[model samples]
Target: MIHRRSGSVGAGAVDGGAGWDGVEPQDYDDPSLGGVRKHELIGEAEGARQYRMRYFEVPPGGRTARERHPHDHGVMIVSGRARVTLGSETHEVGEGDVVYVAGDELHCFEALGDEPLGFVCVVGPRSAS
Candidate 1:
């Protein structure tokens, strides 16, 4: 089954290309992830109660921080090519490639092509307690 969200932003918007109106690309909070920017597509502001969707862009020769989290992640490559490291295994991914990161698994994404590597990721809300 296909799931879709509609509103002022997200997949419902009529904007062309990978970007949406009102969404601004921001630098990755972690400095270790070089030349990475993030655009939040869906989250608490969108009234989503379960998950948040985000788009990440890594410039050529850049990579995401190598870290592990307790929350699982669903990632899909939307543009360019990347070298994704899941645990100890690293694999090359291109457009339309899907990646599943299990809870507490070590993972990172590196842009391998001249253009920016863009990908969308869905993640569950973090527990407050």
Candidate 2:
């Protein structure tokens, strides 16, 4: 069976590709997080037990908490640019680029340029770190 969900272009959203239908805009556990939201795209309700797919949009200059978890995650850059911090290293990424964060690896993402950094991430059910 196919569990399909559609997302529309967000109004004033950077690159117009970061909003999802029926998905609520939620914030992460970061103090410095600028105006942003995370959308859950798929999960157990959709029969995905091993992993969960989620989308996040960080406004320009926004950043995620530099934290780590026991579960690994993979992120696919879907829009805009980002300055990603992995451990003690940093890198610039854009659309179509993929990022992998191993279990317990210190990681963070900061929006670059004038656009919101949006990405779709597939991760273990524990958390999106």
Query: Which candidate tops TM-score?
Result: 2
Off by over 4 Å in 2: 1-11, 14-17, 127-129
Off by over 4 Å in 1: 1-18
Tens digits of per-residue lDDT for model 1, 1-129? 223432232221222234566666677989767567777888776778798889887777889888888889999987778999999999999989999999889999998856678789999995430
> Could you tell me how far off, in angstroms, the CA of residue 1 lies in candidate 2 after the best superposition?
7.8
Error of 1 at 12 (Å): 24
Cα displacement (Å) at residue 75, model 1: 0.5
TM-score of 2: 0.83
Q: TM-score of each candidate?
A: 0.81, 0.83
Highest lDDT among the candidates is held by which one? 2
Q: Where does candidate 1 have its weakest 10-residue lDDT segment?
A: 7-16
lDDT to native, each model? 0.76, 0.78
The residue-by-residue lDDT of candidate 2 on 47-101, one tens digit each, is 7778988888888888888888889889998888899999999999998899999
